[model samples]
Target chain A: MNSPLITRFIFLFVFLSLINAQDKNGYFSLENRLKFGNFLFCKGDYIRAIDEYNFVLTKQNNDTLKFKIALAYQKLERYDESENSFKELFTSQQFGSEAKFEYFKTLYLSDKFETMHKRIADDSFIESSISDKLKRLYNLKHLYSSKSIEDSSKFFQPFNQNESIELLKFYVRKQNLDNKSPALAAVLSAIIPGLGKVYTENYGDGITAFLLTGVLTFLAIDNFNADHNFRGWLFTTLAAYFYAGNIYGSAASAVLFNANVRMNFDSDLTLFLNKNNHFSSNSNLFCK
Target chain B: MKKYIYILILFFCSVSFSNDELARQYEYADKLFNDQNYFEAITEFKRLSFFDEKNVYAYESNYKIGIAYKYGGFYDNSVFYLSHAIRTTENIDERIQAEFQIVRCNILRKTTDRALQLLSQMEKDSVYSNHQNEIHYWKGWSYMISDRWDSAAESFANISDDHELKILSEQVSNDKYSVTFARVISYILPGAGQFYTGNYLSGLMSLAWNVLWGYLTINSFIENRAFDGVAIGSLLWLRFYRGNIQNAEKLAVQKNIEIANTALLYLMENYRGEKP
Candidate 1:
């Protein structure tokens, strides 16, 4: 009985030693691979790093190892694969706040702007480490970049009264910033030709129209005096209508131009403040 | 010694369990493919393919994967996987299916010349005789895309006077109406062709507007309001007169489109016909 018990003890000792050796070997290999992967990632050898990380993932058992594998995939620009890995890490219990932040960054870098905006909107994604000012700035940038002007206005409206006003003005200015609405101005001018120039806010254009109409009237009168009655009558009628139309058009165009200018000025100021981190950061700081 | 034996047995059991699980997964994927859940089916098939690299069903699995992509509107992926299936499979039936599917994928991708070449090659082969009807149908569609109306009509006519295909042939043939006649009728009388095409309300509206403008200009001229006459005659009367002729031709063309679309929809939904 004593001999049997001693043999059992010896067997148990050998079994324990074998298990320890296997664990050590597995962990050492995983660590070495991870180190190499990090080096490759820093060198911008993303493809090789991805391969190494994938190898580690297949051989290692740790959840943390899995998260690093996903990060390496992101560095390789294998966005779809990286998103999958990060999503898995997010679902698992092994990741902490740092992992969560990196996961959000991965999502943002992937141009998944809409998803990132929603994530930031939810307070659960914001921890004590990330400043609220930075969060607001990110949200604003996403608001401007991902959404249409009309959509951005709606999104920015909830931030603050002054910010909303500023954004609205910027969008208005950006609308006609390129000055490509000449055809629209032309149509308005045709309705009263100098009127179009006034609509586009060219005051000199209104004066030019008045002078052209006057000269044509004078030519018609002079031609009629010289007995070119048909040509005179044609010029006179065209000159009469154009002169009246120009006056009407100029007034209408002036109002439209002023409105457009005011809208653009408001927008420009808001965009400038938003870009320089003046509005959102200061507002967030005050709120805190 | 007993403990060591138990440990070895445990490892063997785990490996066998994994193999069994993989087999089960493959079976599940096959069922999904049969059910036409191609997107999800491809995912499961890929997973099984990864785990069991030497699976005898790999050829069938890859073939089905391609078919699933084809049915799911992913033509490029379908072509890629179907080519893989063709290269890998020894099964004659699957090979024929893959070849036909590659042609079908090319057609959907708008690579008509490639599809035509494949169809032409298949037509010369005795083994592909059973696929003639499908090939003809695709050829007709190709002709339609290239706007070769006569050839499209001929292709559709070659199909057996089966009820569905006969209707499609009739639709293609009926679209050959004279646009010149439609334009002539509109020029002779504003909105007459629109009325002929069963658009009485639009025809009457066009006639009323044109007649009103024509009358106003003539009346202004009679009253010696020359300026008013000239302005209304050039801007309003001429615009409406031109618009009436153009509208008449447009109405005829629009009616033709409606007729063709109705027939096409019927063919797609109700016909128990062979598909391309």
Candidate 2:
């Protein structure tokens, strides 16, 4: 009889202990889970961190956690998800300004400048506290994109005077890019076998082209003078191939040169902006 | 007497409570893993590893994290976590399981040298004597991934003579074109190498080009036009001759890649055996 009674007591104790476990501040509790999510967020494991945050959100409404989920998506480069998450907190009193600012930043980072520009044009959507920061991001978007900016004064309105001068240089550089024309290169090469390559700064290839064409042409004329008709015809064909090939090659070189100039300018602008933190708020503010 | 019984029950509950909680956490993470939610499963397993302060779930949590990362194609992270599993466990079988997984990750990531090194080390160990066939299997796979078909055949032969992988490796080795033979033959006979590599059209074209240019240069020399001979010999005849050799070498290499990739594709798609 006592053995049966002990078994029952053991079962009862396990059952009651499990109930207490649920009520206690254990690992699965809402509070403990929130803390764990924050820890994961800080540890740079944002994908897993989002899972923890979403779990906590299912149980309660917390603006800070919501903001964190958006920021984590941004870090993961899941911009669409980040945009939707930030959109949810647009009306939040505490995180509303930060969410609005981060939402535009997400769009900017996603390279959706057109959409971001349209959104920024709506002054009603802008929050007062983060308006200046949003304006800075808006102007930076223009510099990063291919869309032309007309009004210099309006484009530089949000930056400091010193910063404005620096940005103007970038703006001017973008507008007056040193791009060589493929048509002009082809025409020049047609006039002289290697002149286009020389104009495009490909001196080694230009010199080789000049020497190859000059030698082949001289050989064709000399063979004809010596009554070597077969060799003369062969040299003429070879010269024609080289001449046409050099013209086509010079046009390609010009196009490649222009692409490199554009690529260099874009990379330089990106490097400068990254070095200056995009002239806006630091992206690390959410974690703090 | 009742108070003494109550104290014993309370002490038992406290002791078992932490264990049960850790076990429950492990079960939840395992469930997520079974559901194919790998990212969340990793987080939960990490959480279990964090709170199981007595290390009750250490080996299990680490091993599962490794498997989850493997499933997610994160070979580097899989090796890292599986190494943790190997270190945490004292059981020989469990250690071997983790070690095998690390080897698999290395093979999958194309770090064949590392994979072969680990397999060799396992082969030398008395503790892994029972896993000889498994070691040979992975070593064969490592060789296969590196396109060393002959070595792969030799390694798989250590498992059994007629094993499917061994046979496949042998077939691949037999079917491959010899790059050196192709190059040497093309040097002797202008397009013979291309014909040997099964490029009949290219072979005919190359032979025609070489013959036409060769005759023109020799005839020019016979006609006492030394400049014509020099120009044709250096420019036309030599260019076609060198191009024949290069084409033969390139075709042989290309054919070999095709042969190896076909067998590897078959293994990936049709082989019912476990793979890295």
lDDT of each: 0.66, 0.88
Interface Cα RMSD, each model? 10.8, 5.6
Q: List TM-score (chain A only) for every prediction.
A: 0.44, 0.85
Query: Lowest summed-lDDT stretch of 10 residues in model 2 chain A?
Result: A16-25
Q: How many residue pairs collide in each prediction?
A: 9, 0
Query: Candidate 2: where are CA atoms >4 Å away?
Result: A1-29, A32-36, A43-45, A126-128, A139-178, A224-230, A264-280, A285-288, B1-5, B31-47, B50-53, B90-92, B120-133, B159-164, B223-235
lDDT of 2 at A48: 75
TM-score values for chain B across all models: 0.70, 0.94
Q: Which digits, one per residue and each the tens of the lDDT, describe model 2 over residues B137-221?
A: 9999999999999999999999899999999999999999999999999999999999999999999999999999999899988
Residue by residue across B1-276, what tens digits does model 1's lDDT show? 876775565555555545565567678898998888876687667655544545656777777888888888888878888898888878778888889889878877778788888888888998888878777877776665444545666777777655345456556656645557767887888888777777899889888988987887787678665655666576567888888878878877787666666655765688675544
Scanning candidate 1 chain B in windows of ten residues, the lowest lDDT window is B161-170
DockQ: which candidate is best? 2
What is candidate 2's CAPRI-style docking category based on DockQ? acceptable
